[model samples]
Target: MRDRFLTGLIGYPIAHSAAPAMHEQAATALDAHCHYQLIEVAGAGRDDLRAMLEGVRRLGFAGVNVTFPYKEAVVDLLDELTPDARAIGAVNTIVVDGTRLVGHNTDATGFARAIAPLLATKSRGAIALIGAGGVGKAIAFALAGLGAGEIRIFDADAAKATELADQLQGGVAARSVATAVDGAAGLINATPVGMLPNRDTPVPDTLLHPAMWVADAVYSPLWTPLLSAANAKGATVLTGRDLAINAAADAFALFTGMTPPVAVMGNAFDAVMAARYSPSA
Candidate 1:
């Protein structure tokens, strides 16, 4: 039997990732022997990805999380994909069972859990979503699952938004808009505009109003400019921390084969956030 459960993350520029801390904390809370490592594959090609996956499997890693450019690229290399991963066209978590590598996506589940607390009020009307990439696709499907009435998607690459809209046409009353529409019940920023080192807002401040709810997927700073503006205007806001923490908890469960202590994982993430975003830091 394996004494230590080994897992890792495969991504470029992952030196600042908080996943290791969260998973390690979860391991302790569950009284398990787990070691989560980071395997940086910066600028890796398909052949490189194949090699890394092979090496990790041979090394007996339970699983690994994929991020950024490799999420979609790693799908074809997996032996099988979960239904959510297949529909979202991305895989964020890969589980190695014996010789079979199964791909799963926790982003959708995480996003759904993140927005759940607000759905009671936000699900009544239309939702304006920015960006239509991997995370965007997952959130779009999550919104449908949450019973959002209508979804308006906008991307700088107009075709991307249109394509996502077409995918959700029959399921949800979704359409592509040229820009952020006014008077929507909720607005979401799924782009990386407000991420660390970048303070730009994806949608203009004028598009935000006190009557709407706002959610940003960028959590490094926690209080993104978009969320800050929404807060100042009296709009209800949801930060990226909830999404990040919940997703990490779900991935930890997949890696260790144990029920995750979500509260402990959340507290661990809070500690990471405070340390990273503190004024003294």
Candidate 2:
């Protein structure tokens, strides 16, 4: 028997999340009555969190996608953590089976899958990753797992970047801004610098080159200044929307326990982009 009425995403400031649209389209395609909603938990304290979990239990939601500040914070609240999530120290997807909430980290795997085809024919080279926060750490580990020749990290919080580097041991090198992009085959920005209302690129456009591949973890604007600069430089650009779609694919699988129709998910994502930037409905 097919499960009825499942899945949702939890986070603060979730008004912009594409999860509901993506999953709704998927559920529709699968002929499943599942519904996905955005549960805004901003300013929700510990008691509020408990109440929310209890409500999920009472409502029998199949799973929920967790994001941003709550990814780490929700770990302690979960009944169990998958090995991958435990290693990454973050969880972006959670499955509620019986009375147990199992946390899993799909961001790393999702990113690897999305970037693999792009790199399949190209030679692996050094990567300069900016931002050393949770998502940054996950991406760093994913890149290392992919066996990139070298990884360099830079962050305004030098110590935090260094800490991530140390965790990666010899796989990463901590570098200064001037030499950060030097000879790097790829550049990744995991910071919020280019997010909505903040149109600045974390790295200078002067540093971009045709030989480099640029990726930013900020997807809201879809066309971040960094991506624009990379494209102008003739570099291959990977936008955050790509990552979001890929991550949502993984989350969809976790929530439904079935392979998501990538084409359907892609269409839904494009629809979201259209609605978001469309001048008229």
Candidate 3:
């Protein structure tokens, strides 16, 4: 039996990634003995990213999770992209089939799974999104697929937001955070604003209201300032934990061709969060 697997994450500021622990733990539980490393590169350009992907291919790595600033940019560098990835215009998971690197977007699938239970009650009427990069693109497409009436996107880069909106057809580009959240039924943060070491939020707490449901894609803290304020304001809240774990499970399946033990991954994620919050390191 093939008993070894090598996979990893590739992105900058990925010290907060739970991919290694989650994947390794799930694999170890199945006696596969997986090794998931973190390839943290800062300010990598297209050429640098090209080199890294080549290194992964040369080093016999199973695959790697592309995150943050690289997901969309990595699309053009891959050999092929899955239908979902092409539709979302982003790639969060890359599956290596021999020499072929196939890009896939598990972010959309993961977020859909994470928020499915709440969709019946929460308003999918109009959503305000804080990022227009890869994750945001996946979420917008996912919501649209799930029958969202409208997606209002706002990014620090107006062009990016406009681009995403143009793609969505049902999407709108909001000029400011205030405009984005104005009468929004739900607010979601797809940026890195509230992640650890950067204890800030993209939107002010005043914008959150009891009538809104909120979600954040940042799981480093699990409880980001944006979700925190939303929770405090009596809004329905969805943490990034479920989305992270679910996406990772899907990515693991692509990496190892085995059904991931999702419960084990969930436990691993809980452990990572516990250690992060534990006072006695």
Top lDDT model: 3
Tens digits of per-residue lDDT for model 2 on 1-281? 46565888888777777788888888788877678978997877767777777777668798888876577677778889988788777788888888888888778887887777767766678889998876787788888888877999998999978888898898688887557798888899988787777788889888999998988877777889999999999999888876788888888888787778878888898888889878884
Q: Estimate each model's TM-score.
A: 0.93, 0.91, 0.96
lDDT of each: 0.84, 0.82, 0.89
Off by over 4 Å in 1: 1-3, 171-179
Better of 1 and 3 by lDDT: 3
Residue 117 local lDDT, model 2: 71
Q: TM-score rank, highest first?
A: 3, 1, 2
Tens-digit lDDT track for model 3 on 95-177?
Answer: 88889899999999999888778788765677898999999999888888888787889999989898888987845655578
Estimate the Cα RMSD of every predicted model relative to the unseen true structure. Answer: 1.9, 2.0, 1.3
Clashing pairs in 1: none
Backbone collisions counted per model: 0, 0, 0
Query: Candidate 2 — which residues are off by over 4 angstroms?
Result: 43-51
Candidate 3 Cα misplacement greater than 4 A, ranges: 171-175
User: Lowest summed lDDT over 10 consecutive residues: which window, candidate 1?
Assistant: 171-180
- Model 2 clash pairs? none
